[model samples]
Target chain A: MTTSNLHAEIARAIQAAPLLSPIANQLLQVTARADHEMKEVIDLVKCDSLLTARLLRVVNSSAMGLVHQISSVDHAVSYLGERLVVGIAIAECTNEFLGKPLDGYEGESGQLWRHELFTAIASRAVARHARAPLPADLAFTAGLLHDIGKAILSEFLRGTSRELVADIVRGDTADYLTGEQERVGLDHAEVGFELARHWKLPEALAQVIRHHHHPETAEAELRPLIYAVHLGDILAMMGGQGTGSDSMKYHLRQEYAEHFTMSKDDLALLLLECSEEFRKVEASLASLKET
Target chain B: MSQMVLGIGDLGASNHPDAEIKTYALGSCIAVVLLDPQTRTVGMVHIALPESKINLVKAKEKPGYFADTGLPLLLQEMARHGCQPKGKGLIIKLAGGAAIMDHNDTFNIGKRNLLAIKKILWSYGLGPRSEDVGGTFSRTVSVSVRTGEVILSSPGRPNWKI
Candidate 1:
């Protein structure tokens, strides 16, 4: 396929792809609100049976180590509190979409999901450490969805472009993003950005998906959000949680420290903290496993 | 065949002919493979940092997390497995230690890790026979006890024996 045709085809696929279910989207929006009450969140969750089931299963999972079983969404919310419950809900809601492997990226079954979960977990910690101005929920959302395009574009790769991607994944080349752009006419970041737009996600979130690999190109106001997810992706990879094929080709912006007003010492500490956070997230993800 | 995976802060050595040891996603970390060509025993360590001076407690607990501590411990295990000394049928191969594109040179842990491994190995009068180190790529290193051969793989590259 020609460059434009391939881009167009990928765009069509993103539109048809599984999206954040409406209830999940509402739950995320509600969780993002500072004024949201525990009762309000509980009521919102109770309306969706699937979400409620997922929440209870996770809260009661061995990872939580709760002595008591969570019988309902209300019990889960009260026991685990708001943010933890919301994080679980997000994972449950997007489980289907993010769960599949991106063969083009060399991810085996569930590899992409695990990789995104780590990124989401690390993104929140990174945002907190960097003191980003946006709501931490937004950081988590961006991080989780950052690589959604890989799934969409997996089917579109072909010919020499496919070879370049293979080479990039193998570490034969130092630039996967650039190599994709040069050979395939677009990269996953750009595809993810368009995907987010198609879903009508927040403008900032779309920009983040686009500029994550190149935070320097994002608008000044969105840099922190972009940087948080950017650094989170880097931290996840360096922590050895990379998905497949494209684990270590991207760059880590040095100016991120200056931009976020953090020192090198602070960055290192954040990584240590993120690694700890990653383990917790990994354990919690057990809830997503087949029962 | 028995295959063992070495995590980020792990080390293992094997003398069994059917054993194959491996480690993956070695970013900014170093993977050292030591082998006894004659005995066909193999030792591998995945070292995540250059030194243990900063986190002595962690280093003490997981000696495989740093080149300074892990390299020596890995060599000791090789000896326990009946590996010959320095140039007498002993082979060392190195892989991993890749800095990202935008990371400042000062914080290049990959470079630091390679240097630390070199320093420690030099202290013991040993150096790598072949290396696939540096660059902005994560690699997986594997060694087979039967053949005493080391293979290195990166994201999109073919597995090349070192």
Candidate 2:
């Protein structure tokens, strides 16, 4: 689609996608305190049984590589500390809120999860070098749930026309995004931004989802956060885990680093740090398997 | 299938059964299961996130992300061809789940994926003889049970043996 058409469609999708309804009460009360404290957040998380169990399972899982047994939420929180602890809690919370698969991509089932994790990693790395106010955990949650709109409209789009989606899979953006815009009148980014606003996530994060691919227009206040998260996604896509069935069409823009005011050295450091961090996190995760 | 590069949502196994089943660029997404000793059964699913205990409907929609829903289904599918979950030892080797999100911190998916698999294994109490998982660079993984090799290749050259 033309740039103007693309912009309009994305704007429309933002209108239709699933997000917290202002009328609805908070989905769940959360008391996640910053400054890396754990007990307070644990108390809030413990109130939710499913979250509690999942958190415990996550704590005990061999994937983490931590042999320590964390019996209580408080203990689990303390053991992992705030950054990692909050990240895990956010992962648990995210699964509940994020809807089904998106219509455009062939996620099959778990594609969103994969995308989220990678996004989180990418954001943390980008923000570290950029030194933006955005917290790694906040970006992680934002990145994890960015493409949520895709799931909400997957069935509708599937029924709308399989051929259009086939074209998107084939990287015919003009047709795919345009078709999506015509049908839903908005793209996934707009929809996701709305969801973020409704969720009361950091405004910057919401904007990141809204303008991640094209942060030039994001609100000035939210620009840096959006840029960091955007670059994170781009990096993950570059890493090539899964940019959906239509990845070939979207190439990474080198200007993102400059937009975020990151130096080449900074970008190199981000990648270098990410690589080292990937190993550490991977090792920690490996140990967390269910025993 | 094509040996070139099987991007996400695309599964490709080497046409030759004797040949290896290789897929690169795996991070948090699963490399699925690749079994060769018996019949040519290699499943690779690129699950983006983790399970949604709170959202069962979403879970139903995304069995690949959640260990609770995805593993049993995958195992059952493999079982259709006499590869029962409990009976035979399928030398399963897993990789990916490198938390690119947090460098100072680590997300639970890499851990969760591992845990989910372990729980499935616990039901049957099965574990891979060994594995090479969790790194920053996207992994170039190859699993050939027939040859008993699960090689992982990162972006830079000099991939390691499993």
Error of 2 at A137 (Å): 2.1
Second chain alone, TM-score for each candidate: 0.93, 0.70
| lDDT by residue for model 1 (B60-161), tens | 988998888898788778777777544356688899887666677544667877988999888888888999887766788888888888888765566788
lDDT of 1: 0.75
Give the TM-score between model 2's chain B and the true chain B. Answer: 0.70
lDDT of 1 by residue, A1-291 (tens): 688887777778888887777776776667655566778888988898877777777777787777877796778878766656666665665676677766666666777776777787778777876654656667877788788777777666533434775566576755777776776688889888888877767677788889999898999988988888998788777666777666767878776775565554454455555665666657766766767
Q: Supply DockQ values for each candidate.
A: 0.44, 0.05
Best by TM-score: 1
Q: Candidate 1: lDDT of B56?
A: 81
Kindly report the fnat of each predicted structure, to 2 decimals: 0.46, 0.06
Q: Best candidate per lDDT, number? A: 1
Q: After the best TM-score superposition of candidate 1, give how far the Cα of residue B51 lies from its true spot, in angstroms.
A: 2.8
- TM-score per candidate, in order? 0.87, 0.53
